[model samples]
Target chain A: MQETRLDTARIRAARQAIDPVFLDTPLYRCEALEPGLGCAVSVKLETANPVRSFKGRGTELVASLLAGDGRNAVVCASAGNLGQALAWSGRARGLDVTVVASRSAPAAKLERIRAFGARLELVDGDFDLARERAAALARQEGIRLVEDSLDIETCEGAATIGLELADAAPTFDAVLIALGGGAMATGVGHVLKELAPGVEVICVQPLGAPAMTFSWRRRRVVTTDSTDTIADGVAGRRPIPAVLDDLLVVADDAVLVREESIIAGMRLLLEHAGLVAEPSAALGIAAILEDRDRFAGRHVVTIVCGGNVDLDAYHRWIGAAPAHRS
Target chain B: MQETRLDTARIRAARQAIDPVFLDTPLYRCEALEPGLGCAVSVKLETANPVRSFKGRGTELVASLLAGDGRNAVVCASAGNLGQALAWSGRARGLDVTVVASRSAPAAKLERIRAFGARLELVDGDFDLARERAAALARQEGIRLVEDSLDIETCEGAATIGLELADAAPTFDAVLIALGGGAMATGVGHVLKELAPGVEVICVQPLGAPAMTFSWRRRRVVTTDSTDTIADGVAGRRPIPAVLDDLLVVADDAVLVREESIIAGMRLLLEHAGLVAEPSAALGIAAILEDRDRFAGRHVVTIVCGGNVDLDAYHRWIGAAPAHRS
Candidate 1:
């Protein structure tokens, strides 16, 4: 397997370069959840920041680098989170950010992207069409085209979460990451394998969109005709080549969970942990629920990657029945 | 007005005596909430800690002091949050805690009190009866009796929150604090009056339990026959004399909100701020909605004091109708 470019030394010092708001997120052990999971479960809540997601760490580092390098403009394709993150990070560093997204993206995320002072371009089609538009726009404007999982700076920025988790807890059996563009999974895995070598790094993906899962298992890039999942954060129709290489190097195991399980996980997080976790953020909890026996009696840590779920959709998807009827 | 025992000097240095987890909570500015409040709104999320409440700050500080003073045994009457908080804090300090609660107290809080390893005594009446039983038990067992709003140490500890908020933002028009047993309200008020004197210190209470509200306005203790509200955290039929004195001296204004407004505030917090605030914690938002003109075009800060609502009752009280019906 080819070596990944993520560095542990840089992750050790990443906190200094990254924004303070994204560092030292709450790592809470909810005893209420132990009975359900049959294991000691802790959540590193990454949803309480300015961007309400873990994307800020990497985005901040990259935006700071751009500021130092005198690159004043950039473009990126986002489902929602990365766009908001880059916009916030860019504004903080006085850099111009242009975010391209599908017109079908959730208004909750799009509103935040615009609120953060980024120029938003909405394509008529899907995420791939938005990506192509972003690439074309970057070339036309003579600016950089930023992609989440493919950037070395982004990966190294994400590694800081692993750096923090290792420093916070002395030991845990495993750490679960929600598998999406593979930036968080591969970046966190790289840090844990080096700092907390005893930990087993696990990646969880929705069964509906499991390109990374298939690629990691088959040892090559995997592509699907289309993605169909409610968890837009973890939905990938085609796996990036470089992210595939890093996923193989970082993850010890990969699990695919059904759509219902993802909804159940989101509910569990709300009921037990007293937090609102978006569908993609709850993928770890779903994986554990799918195979309770495997995680039983073991201590585990999971990251709540975001909390940008549209309230109306959240209530519908989480099986929120009318209390009067119940 | 009688002088409050809360000291600003101690509050500025209180972090040294408190647990690191309860300090420096997330202060996020949500743009979506801005339009609703007709002003910039920032939330100091005090619910993401181990106990899921701001109670940890005072409880931890008092626990440390008790440990230092060689008081190994203590008893307190709690409606749930205080019991759970004392249990967790006592365990950390190697002190024994006995909690007294009314038999009708919510099972969610009772379960957590027991989980924290506190010896719980159940009374057959209301919170007033529970307090009486706790006092009787303390006399019989020869242990110290601790009451939240009556204790100077608790108030001083709560003041730390105000110190941090003042340090966080250079200025804001006002701050809204949910008036419960008045520990947080008085403690935070004392610090802000000392440091951020220009900022308005507004206390919010439920219309069903307006003892503190009336007492603050009258500059004397007030008592009510009964309390009826969904916000148990702020339900007080009889105001503590010491706390009433502190309230009169600290609070610039007091607002009473109806039951429906409190529920609406809880919903606003969930939808706009992306948080699960119990009825009491959402009082700040309730006050804003009650008189939008008062806070219009101003930057205000509010504390989400806790997130310990029972999921089933939460759904019922929040008017969570089925999506299909909508």
Candidate 2:
């Protein structure tokens, strides 16, 4: 296996370079959740930041580097969270940001992107098509294309979350992370493996969009015909090559949770943790709920990554009757 | 005016004695909120703690002191959040806690109080009557009365929030705090006045429950016949003597906001900041929105102090059409 690009030294520096608003979020033990799961669970709250998501850490670091390199403009394609992060971070650094979002992107997230003063381009396609369009736009003069999972700086920046967890709760038996474009899992996994070598790093993906999980299992990039999940943040159809490469080296295990479980996890977070987590960010909790016996009597940590759910959708998802699962 | 009992020295010690879960919550700028309000606003998010409210800080400190003084049991009367805080803190210290609550207490909060291992006693009267019953119960053998705002230790513990805000954002022109039994306002106001002397400390109360506000304006304790508002946390019928004393010394001004404005603030927090703040916690934002002309071009800080709203109620409140407010 090829050596991982993320290291402790780079992660330490990224911790300093990233914006302060995105760093050192609260990592506390969830009293309401521990008894039911029969384990000690610590939640790292990433939703408390300016953008209400963990995407700002990686996007801010990447945007700062682009600014330092004298780049005038940057382009990216996102489901929602990444676009908002890039737009906010780019505006902070006085760099122009153009986000290519799928036409089906949630209105709440789209509003945030425009609110951050970033130019938004809606593409009549999926996330992959938006990425293709962003790539083509990057070829224009003085434009840098920054992909979420493929960018090494973005991954290293996200490693700061691992550094924080290690400092806050070093005795965890394992850490559960939501897998989207794979930067979160790869970055956090790389640092935890180095600092807490005995701690297992598990990646969780929604069953509706298991592209990254399938690719990790097969040891190759995989593309799905369709991605159907309420977790729009993690519903990518194609896996990025660099993200898959990093996952192969860093992730110890991967689990898939049903869509219904994800919705249940979202409600649990709101009811117990007083958190308003988007569907994608709740996958880690969903994974633990789905396989409770494996985590029983163990010290575990899960990242509550984002809280950008639409109010209407949140009400519908939480209030709806539980779907019958065979 | 009499010297405030809540000094910076006590606040500093309380910071060390209090539970770490309630300390150093996120203090960040709200980009989406700033443009509309025409002022730079920073939010101190107290809802991120385990209890999902600022009550944990005061309750934890008081509980520890009770344990140190060889107390075996304690009794308190609360509308909701305080009971949960005491129950959780009491359990941590191995002290039995009995909470006297009114029948009108939110069911969601009652469930949490029980979940934290507290004995609940329902009274058929209002919050003040519940307090009277709790005071009588404290006369029992081996039971101490733990009053929310009257306890100097509880106020001192809550003062740690002022310490954190002073350290985090000291340049604010004014700080808007939600007034509930006057403990939060008195505690935070006391410290901010000492540290940031020029920064105005404004206390916000619902127009329906103007006990503290009326008392502050009258320069003495005031009682109201009935308290009616959606912000159950702050809807107190009478002001505690000790709390009113502290507020007289520390609070610069007090304002009353309409119930409709409070609802608007709650919705704004959810839509703009992605925070699920309870109605009481949204008072600071409500004050700003109701009188936007006063805060224009100024740096202000608002404490989003709690996130204990029920999901069903949250949906109903946010989904409802805007009331015709002139």
Q: What value of lDDT does candidate 2 attain over all alpha carbons?
A: 0.86
lDDT of each: 0.86, 0.86
* Candidate 2, CAPRI quality class derived from DockQ: acceptable
Residues A18-55 of candidate 1 have per-residue lDDT tens digits of: 88888888887777877888898888889888889999
Each prediction's DockQ? 0.45, 0.37
lDDT of 2 by residue, B1-326 (tens): 34887778878988777888799889888877887678988899998877888999999899999999998899999988999999999999999999999888888788889989999999997889999999999986548998888988778877888998888555689999999798889999988888878888999999999999999999988899998899988888879887898899999999999988887788788777888899999999999989999999989899998888776666567763322212
- Error in Å for residue B294 of model 2: 1.8
Native contacts recovered, in order, as a fraction for each? 0.53, 0.45
| Model 2 lDDT per residue over A1-326, tens place | 24687877888988777888899898887878776667788889998877889999999889888889888799999888899999989998999999999999888888899989899999998888899999989887448998888888778878899999877555688899999888889999988887777788999999999999999999998899988899988888899887898898889999999988888788788777778889988888888889999998898899999888776776577763222211
TM-score on B-chain, cand. 2: 0.96
TM-score of 1: 0.94
- Scored against the native two-chain complex, candidate 2 gets a DockQ of 0.37
Candidate 1: regions farther than 4 A off: A1-3, A322-326, B1-3, B322-326
Pairs with backbone N, CA or C atoms under 3 Å apart (clashes), candidate 1: none
